[model samples]
Target chain A: MVLFPGSNCEHDVVAAIEGLGGTAELVWHGDRSLHGVDVVVLPGGFAHGDYLRPGAIARFSPVMAAVTDHAAAGGVVIGICNGFQVLAEAGLLPGALQKNRGLKFLCRTVELRVETARSALTTEVPVGTILHVPINHFEGNYTCSPETLAELRADERVVFRYVDNPNGSIDDIAGICSTGRNVVGLMPHPERACDELTGSADGRPLLRSLLTAGLATRPA
Target chain B: MKFPVLVEVKLREGIADPQGATIERALPALGFAGVEGVRVGKAIRFMVEAPDETAARALVTKLCERFLTNPVIEDADITVG
Candidate 1:
């Protein structure tokens, strides 16, 4: 996982992965290498004080060059919440996240319907599977041009859609994958939902899917 | 030459401005009238060093396009002096 200065969810993601019997590590934002990790995760938090905009300053962090290289090499990259904003700002993903429709910071569990099972993030789950995930953000409303939206829909790159449209995201989109299908950005934090003791373990399948995908591409 | 640059960033038309709308909603309660189309944005000010005004404007415009604003949802209007 990549750890920006203000990133608070790195530990949560590491704990979640470890609980599922997977190993994880943290790479500082200033570090320029991913250390050959097959899967790169940009955890959620207010990086760089969310200066200028959420994820804006973080996109220029030295480690992002390495992240971009990893993505371009077909490695799996996942960005959750503020990480999603970073990916968008870095041009790793399409569209941008603006302020939520109600101008309120939402922190709650939301139902996310898996729209497709072909991408790395959802390959282990069946389509239409509803995963209860927690989202915490003040600017999670996803926006994209009409052309890009049509392209995303036609290409079946939209991996998840909100069942209730909590933040007024266009097309009720909660997650999407890149054309290569190896990169994903989503507003919800699956790491926060990995334990039944916390609330739900629906996030396990998603993380498991990611780990499985990573194993497939691991250098043996 | 040092030029003072002002960049006004606004959400593109047709995009929802909830912050502006929320502020507008409270206006009627305050007995203010004749208010509509409330939208919110930000102003960014900086200084750029260039040989000429044209060069300064171009430099600032590049900054606006690449860093100062997100063109997907916001447009940046630049004023250089």
Candidate 2:
């Protein structure tokens, strides 16, 4: 896990990873280097005061240059909530995170409909399966030009959509992947939902998928 | 003469605005009472060097299309006076 300024959930995400036998590193937003971390995560919170757009100003942070470079080399990038917004702003991913249709800070667990099972991230999840993840964002709506949205749909780039459409995202998208699903930005907090019966445990499958992906890449 | 054009960019009806909320929370401390319904929007003020309002509107539209809003989530209204 990387800690950007204004990030309030790094510790929790780190704890979740730690509980899962993974070490999470806190990377400050000011640092320009990635420091040998295998996976880069942009945790949720308000960054650069969420100016212009939710993640607009933060896209220019010195650390992002390295992040973009790392992702270009097929490194995994996971952005949650505001982190997702930042990914879109950085153009590492297409589309934009718009304000939620209700115009309120919605905080609750919602069901996410898994749209694809091909990505390394979603290899553990079956397509069309419903998983519960807590979403606490006002700018969780995903939007792109109709042509782009259509193309994404045609290309299987859309990995998930909120089953309930909590936010008025284009085509009700809640999660998306890059061309190869190597990089994913999700508005829901999988870290917050990794435990079943805890209301957040529904997120464990996604995290579990990360480990599964790492294992798949290990030397045979 | 400088004409002040209002370029209000409000979150599309239901967009979440944490920045606006943070500012609103501080307004009471700043003695801004009766400031109800304070939804923060972006107002960009730029002087257009066009020959006339029609040309200005066209340029602004292009700017809006290419840069201002994503066209999928936001709608920009360009008015020249």
Candidate 3:
């Protein structure tokens, strides 16, 4: 887990990963290395107090240097919620997360549909499968240039889309992977939905899917 | 020399701006009429230390593209004084 100073979801993500029989370690934003980790996750929260913008400040964090290198090496990187914003700001992903169309901080459970099963983040989940997850953010509406949107469509990089379009995101995109399909960024908080009592257990397959991908990338 | 920079960031022309629309709708209810094409944007002020005005302008422009605004969906107007 990559822990930005203001990130509040690191523990939640760590707990979820542990619950799924996966070991997780929190790496501070100032850290200069990934410690040879298999996968890197940028969890949710108001990083750098969301100053200037949600992820603008956090993108410049030292740990991001290692994260960038990891992604370049085809290592798995999943950026959730605020983490997604950081990835977009860092140019690791296309487009930007603009303020919600309603201009309010929305916190609620939402339904996401798997749009493509080509990414490691969603490969276990069959296409068109709907997963219940929670999203909490004031800026989760994703926007990209027309050219980039076309490229995403052509490459089939959109991994997930909202079932009901909660945040006015273009094409109802909830998650997307990079061209190489190793890096994924999404708005919904799958970690928040790992439990049956609190949220939903639908997030299990998604998290497990990452473990499978990590195992593949593990130095053998 | 050090120059004060003002960066104004606005959403792209075609993007849906609900906040701006909401404010526009409120204007007529407040007895203000004929206010059309209302849009909302953000202004950021900072100091830039550069060698000359041309360099300062170039720096601000780069900042606008790199950090101050999302070039994909927004445009930034930068002024150095």
Candidate 4:
């Protein structure tokens, strides 16, 4: 996973991945190569200090260009919170993140409904299964056009929907899959809510769910 | 080279745009009700051709995702002519 300079959640995400017995390496955002890594995770945090928009500046980082190339090559990219913002800014995903509708910084643990079990991840859960995850952000709303929304629905790319919807999201969307489904960006902090010590283990499956899918896209 | 491009952006809706409505209401008070459809919006302009359509679409979408619009509170669309 690439760590942006201001990423507050990198260590936490590392701990969560480590605690889950998953191997994770933190690569600085400026690194130019994936170093043979099969998947790249963009951990949540205030990249470029969240200046001029949550991740507008971070999208242009030296590492983002490499990340974009990797994602285009079918490498898996998972972004959470500010990471999601960076992905949107880098055009890895669709939509943008903005200040909350109420214009307040929101911090809470919320429930999310699994929209598809067939996705690269979340295949272990049944559709509609709920999981608890934490979210912290001023701009985490998921917005997209009605036409794009329709295309996503028709393509079944909606991966997760917030059950509690801590923030206002179009169609209650909490997570989405890329056109290839291997790339996913979600607002909820699954890494932060992945432990029993965190008082909830609901975020556990998301990390491990796709471990068996074979990292990266299968040979064509 | 003057060419057509599609720019997508979003502004707050009636309930969400306090800035826009403030401007609208103040217009009437300032004797500018002539601007009844006073709503705030964003403009994105670019250039493209048939061969450039796919690249243009992708690039414009990237621009929308990156800068031209915010994905959460704001919505976006593209026009090509």
Candidate 5:
């Protein structure tokens, strides 16, 4: 896991992953290497105080160089919420996360339908499976050029779609994967919903799927 | 030399800006009529340690495009002095 200065969700993600029998550690943004980690997670938060824009400054962090290298090698990278913005700014993902359509900071649980089972993040999730996850953001509305949207669809990059269209994202896109299916970015916080005590356990399957993916790539 | 630069980023035309519209709607009720085409944007001011104005402008434009603004949904207006 990568921890940008303002990141508050690293521990949450760590706990979730650890609870699922996965060893996770935080890699500071100032660091310039992944140290041979298989999965790099960019947890959600107001990185670099969200100055200029969300993920704008964090995208230039030294660790990102290693992240790009890792992803290019087909390593799995998951960016959640503000992490998603970082991925977009880093050019690892297409489209931009602009202000929500209603211009309000939305914090609520939303239904997300698994769109593609091809990506590492959704491989264990059956297509059309609905997961109730919580999203908290002011700039979570995803927008892209028409051509990019067409490409995303044609390439099977979209992985999740909102069931009720909470933030007015184009095509109700809630999450998407990279062309290689190794990188996934989403607005919802799966970590927050991983336990039943938190009101929902829909996130379990997603995290388990990631764990399954990681195990597959584990060196023999 | 140090040059001052201003970069304004606004949502491209045809993109809905509910924040601007909400403010515009509030203006009419506050007796400020005839307000139309309200759009919200971000203004960024910074100083660049470039050798010349042209260099500063070029640097600032690059910054605007690469980081200060997301060209996918925004248009940037940059000025250097």
Candidate 6:
């Protein structure tokens, strides 16, 4: 996990991974190396106080060069919420997240239907599976060019779709992956929903899938 | 020489501007009718050390394209003095 100064969900993701019996560690944003971690996760938060834009400043962090290299090498990269914004800003993802259509910071559980089971985050989950996940963001409306949208759909890169449009994202897309299917970005925070005590554990399948993928790729 | 640069960033045409729309919707109630296309944007002001106005403008444009604005969904109007 890459930890920016303002990252707030590093511990949540750490706890969720540990709860599932997986080891997770934080790599500071100033560090230029990932230390050979199998999976790179950019956890959610208002990094750099969301200055200029949600993820604009954070994208230039030194650790991102390593993160970008990891993704290019076919390693798994999962970006949740603010992490998703950073991914988009860094050009790892194709779209940009703008202000919500309602212009309100939404904090609630939303139903997300798995659109494809081919990506690192959804490999174990069946397509069409509905997961109740929580999304908390002020600027989560995803927008992209028509050409890019067409390409994403054609490549089966869209991993999740909102069961009901919540933030007016184009085509109700809740999450998408790179053409390689190795890098994934989503506005909803699966880490926050991994425990039953937190209202729903529907996120376990997704996180577990990530862990499984990471373990499979771990160097011997 | 140092120049003052201003960059106004606005959402690209066809992209939804919720903050702008909300403010536009509330304008009529305030007796300010006939207001249309009340798009909201931000202006960034900074000083850049450059040789001339053209260089300053070029530098600011580069910043806008790479950092000041997200070309995916925004346009930046830059002014240098």
Best candidate according to DockQ? 6
TM-score of each: 0.98, 0.76, 0.96, 0.76, 0.96, 0.98
Error of 2 at A127 (Å): 1.2
Provide the TM-score of chain B versus the true chain B for each model in turn.
Answer: 0.95, 0.63, 0.94, 0.64, 0.94, 0.95
Model 5, which residues run further than 4 Å from truth? A218-220
Clashes of 5: 0
Candidate 3 residue pairs that clash? none
TM-score of 3: 0.96
Residue ranges of candidate 1 with Cα displaced over 4 Å: none
Cα error of candidate 6 at position B26, Å: 0.7
Interface RMSD for candidates 1 onward, in order: 0.6, 4.6, 1.3, 3.6, 1.0, 0.4
Report lDDT (CA) for all predictions: 0.93, 0.78, 0.91, 0.76, 0.91, 0.93
Worst 10 residues of 3 chain B by lDDT: B65-74
State each candidate's clash count.
0, 7, 0, 2, 0, 0
Tell me the tens digit of each residue's lDDT in model 3 across B1-81. 999999899988898888898899899999999998888999999999999999999999988888888777789888889
lDDT of 4 at A68: 85
Model 6 native-contact share:
0.94
Model 2 lDDT per residue over B1-81, tens place? 333454555656554555577677789999997776556667777777776777777778887665565544566656567
* Candidates, DockQ: 0.93, 0.22, 0.75, 0.23, 0.83, 0.94
Better of 2 and 3 by DockQ: 3
- TM-score of model 6 relative to the true fold? 0.98
Clashing pairs in 1: none
Per-prediction share of native contacts kept? 0.94, 0.33, 0.78, 0.33, 0.89, 0.94
Query: What lDDT tens digits, residue by residue, belong to model 3 across residues A1-220?
Result: 9998899999998999999999999999999999889999999999999998899999989999999999998899999999999999999999999889878888999999998888878879999999999999889999998889899989999999998988899999988999989999999999988989995989889999999999987777
Worst 10 residues of 4 chain A by lDDT: A210-219
